[model samples]
Target: MGAVSKEPTRFTVEANASGAARYALGDRADFADVERGLIARFDEIKNERGETVLDASTFSFIRQGEDAPAGVDASLWRQSQLVIQLGLYKVVDHLFQVRGNGANLTIVDAPEGLVVIDCMEGVEMAAQAMRLFREHVNDKPVVAVIYTHTHFDHYGGVKAVVDEADVESGEVALVGPGTVESFNKYALGENVIVGNAMSRRASYTFEALIPHGVSGAVTQGIGPGGGSHFTTTYIAPNDSITATGETRTFGGWEFEFLYAPDTEAPEEMHIWIPAINAVTCAENANHTMHNIQTLRGARTRDARNFARYLDETLVRWGDRVEVHFGPHTWPVWGNANVVAFLESQRDLYKYMHDQTLRLANQGYHPIEIAEMVQLPDAIGKKWFNRYYHGSLHHNVRAVFAKELGTWDGDPASIWPLPPAENARRYVSLLGRDAILAEGTRAISEGDYRWAVQILHHLVFADPADAQAKELQADAYEQLGYQQEAPQWRGIFLTAAQELREGAATEGGLNTASSETILAMPMDQLFDFAAIHVVGERAADVDLRIGIVVNDTDERWTAWVRDGVMNARPQESQNVQATITGPKQAVVAVLLDPSRAGDLVSSGVLTIDGDESVLASYGSVLEDFDPHFNLVTP
Candidate 1:
């Protein structure tokens, strides 16, 4: 569609994509026959302002009818075509899924009313998904909403399908495992500290910054990429599913939930509908490999536990599972196919973990292990097992980082110089011309990895170097064009764009969204506030402030010591100042110091001792610029 790259495409990439397509042809049945029964396709979803939330037409540039473009991988293009097929598809009897509407929203027909699982992302998309669901299927009020996990994609659009009034009046039951706590912690907590970094990195991870085309963003590897631009909202769950083998019949449908926490998400679970002989694997077993530690930073997932959970799914519900679906991809039919899918997924994680550990035991570092570990035929050869979302390189290192820390136990590697310093030193030692000469040679020889590494040092050493930056961007473009994983391509391309043009003017989640701020517990709020306290600024200042919220009787003591801020539930014994206020007032002042005037004026705030102690403590708190430079700084 765009000016395609002239660089030679690798034979391995073509072979890999061809192999994947052939495997799919052999192993998969007719997916289109299942799609034909869809009631309707609502591709155009718009917001109140008439802005497209999930534009199905954005991906129309890459037509399914056309052959794979020169720069794009054929298998990935095929997956892209599958992901972009926006419609309501019938999974089985009484079960329907509105796929390609951002996230897959599955509608289950119950006797009393309709039950919906996984509410896309925003009100716009969710409402459209619900509308699509109602059009093909029978129109019934949503009696219950089931969230398989704590992720926002599974539950954020709750307000769209059912009213809060219904949920409040007990007409609708909001169900999930660890939904509220997990949502608050991951979605809201400490977002102010790391939100921008995560958002920027996620933009790359999901190809949000790139346009959708053959040479640009194709698919997210799990789904299509047009749903990135949307408002994020969360609706807390009322009914919690705590443990595995938990069975609950809502409106006459018996549903069993299996808790699989710390697998794909921090708090996640899989669902089994015994009545229909169907199972929802949540985000656990998707079309693509799920991330352990996402490119957007998160706590490392336990690979061992992840593998075990998949095995547990097989042992618990494999025999009865005739149809299996997830929040991302198409449904898998037939018991044998479902078993193979689950088993391959199970072994995929197990092999990645075991092999990484085996290599780590032999004193191989993360980089070495990542390069060395390879999936066997049973796991890697299958089309479903292809690394679209997750790859061997990153996942292998993730496993290593989990079992062995980043240290690598090498004394020489312990204290490496920072990037800028090291880059400058390298440039000075080797000479800029010499470095550029070698990088230029690598680029010509199609050794892009080496070219990127060398050119990166030259650019960082002198950000004003036009030739170095240009060459690096070129190298990144070529690598991006060749990458099978969409996220890796997105990251490389975004980096190149930033180098060529400039950093993005706007992007990132609102850390202080009204709902997110209100739902936060006082303790979690305090923990987030602690992160804002600049360690360098508080290094020499020993300030202790005891907070007493008269409204809630919640007491907290926050102190700065050794350049770090620490907070505990109990009040300090020896406090410099005791600040007493209502819970709302205290929270307001804690979040925004400017609100202190309003609280003080209303007689809602009072200081017992030296107010300077509180003032000094507040002064150390730094506001991070969310728009900080990424590639350069």
Candidate 2:
């Protein structure tokens, strides 16, 4: 009773029947030239029973070193191979996506045990989701864990599925929403300051450290949440659901919740499954068109409240869904293709909020309606491609802040000045050979986002032009090879491989630990000091200072007005230190200004009102130096 058609051959995966690992991978190896270019780009948009179907056996390949040993260094480090073919879904049986970008992980077997939802990214994918649930559902013992969102590939593999004697000896239950102030700033706000500034374009946009073959790096065929960390930390949620259509029914799985604050995530939830009609759309109905600001920056979503939570989650579970599942990819069965894939991902977030307000009501701002908004033909011939994780110039500035708000209405574009002294007086009035010949004629008219804004002002007006920094690193590696947004193809191919290689000198930025900065929370350490708090050196010091911890009794009061670096709860006092143990013993005495009094003499710190006023307020705190440099020198 199932001979349906049009792509989607019922459920993918079926390839690599070893037979001598297919004659020990021959066809000019980089693993047979990336599986013969993903079988000739899925035979140019497949559909004849989608040819040999999915073709991704089990999955996990690494070669820029996984401590070289598999099959006697399989061709001894073939230029650091990496393919991570994601797919782990048992959702409803010891439930697992257990490592995402191949989504939907359920794990609810009951009879008083197991509860997980999303958790992908190692402990070998939570030991391959406990060996595919003790060989097909029920080998019991897990009890609880439900971090539906606050990404890092959905709860960085909770110590590879429960430990520290099962969450500090309570035996599971963990859970979500405001999860301990979202896991205390979730690994220093996105892998220590926006994934070392969007992982220098996420290692050439998930080529996992560069592979320009077939237009450079590609695993973001969407599905497999990535932020890299395995034992990162996330067991908070000793149960909390917060409003919007919440329901429970634990173990035996009834779920049905919705809350999902600030859309696609910022404290999220979505589950629904009145007995496996399945919904779970947690990265808010994925299939592409996510992210609003994210260029390693945050706090800016609401594309009209993400199209009114998918037009009220398709009027509350559009006829009890049929199958949706996600955390990254895979899973979307029938029921009219899950209500036309949640009404085309809810009209692709209402056509990026009605064509960025029909070209900002024709006045066009927000980077000229994000350089004239596109994506029609019903969300651009859906393959759910944005290559992986939201793009379209951050959803036309999330529809010009949903019709102009966070002040892009302009006062000379709201007091702008310091994008490196407005890129050194616009390269001293377009000089450096007329902004490197209008950034090499806007990268030979492919216009790569205006040739990455005229090669970021000729690499900030000549940071010693090595031929205008190697022709703006070959126009940011051909706009990170026509990006389909894996963070805008790793931020224009990690700013053209750091203007042809530069940053990352010295150290400190593979990321996480002082137990991930004593696990973040005084509201994500004031949202990671509102992203590296300098706010004009905390508004050139009006500074308040009072703080206390004495090991988590917690006290806060750090204000620094007008320029903005606020912190609350002092009531009234100049009090500067009632200090304590961990929060990296006060970020190792406030993020290093030559390790204050040698970290209060290495006893992790115990301060006073004036250890030179916590060393003149931790020298205006802001050490985000994740191996610096976004573009060139």
| TM-scores, all models, native as reference | 0.90, 0.32
Segments of candidate 1 deviating more than 4 angstroms: 1-36, 165-171, 179-187, 190-193, 508-514, 540-563, 568-588, 598-618
* Tens digit per residue, CA lDDT, model 1, 139-253: 8878899888766566667788888878778778888777566645765563434655666677777777667776677888777756744555666676878789988887799
Best by TM-score: 1
TM-score of 2: 0.32
**Residue-by-residue lDDT tens digits, candidate 2, 1-633:** 011101111111011122123222342323332232121111111112433212332123442434322211122122223234333344333334433333434565655667677666434455555665666545777777777767655665576677756666755667676545554354346665555565444444443444323333334445322323334444555666777677776665667777767766667777775666677668777656677665445556776666677667778987777666666544566578778877887777777777888878777777777767777766655545232566776678766875577677667868888676787788887677787788778766656567677767766766777777766666665545444355555555555555665654642224344445456566555555556656676676665655565566677776656666667755346654455545656655545535657666877766665556655556676665545665653
- Candidate 1 residue-wise lDDT at 143: 84
Q: Lowest-scoring 10 consecutive residues by lDDT in candidate 2? A: 1-10
**What is the TM-score (0 to 1) of candidate 1?**
0.90
- RMSD (Cα, Å) for all candidates, in order, is 3.4, 22.8
Error of 2 at 447 (Å): 20
Relative to the unseen true structure, what is the Cα RMSD of model 1? Answer: 3.4
How many residue pairs in model 2 have overlapping backbones?
A: 24
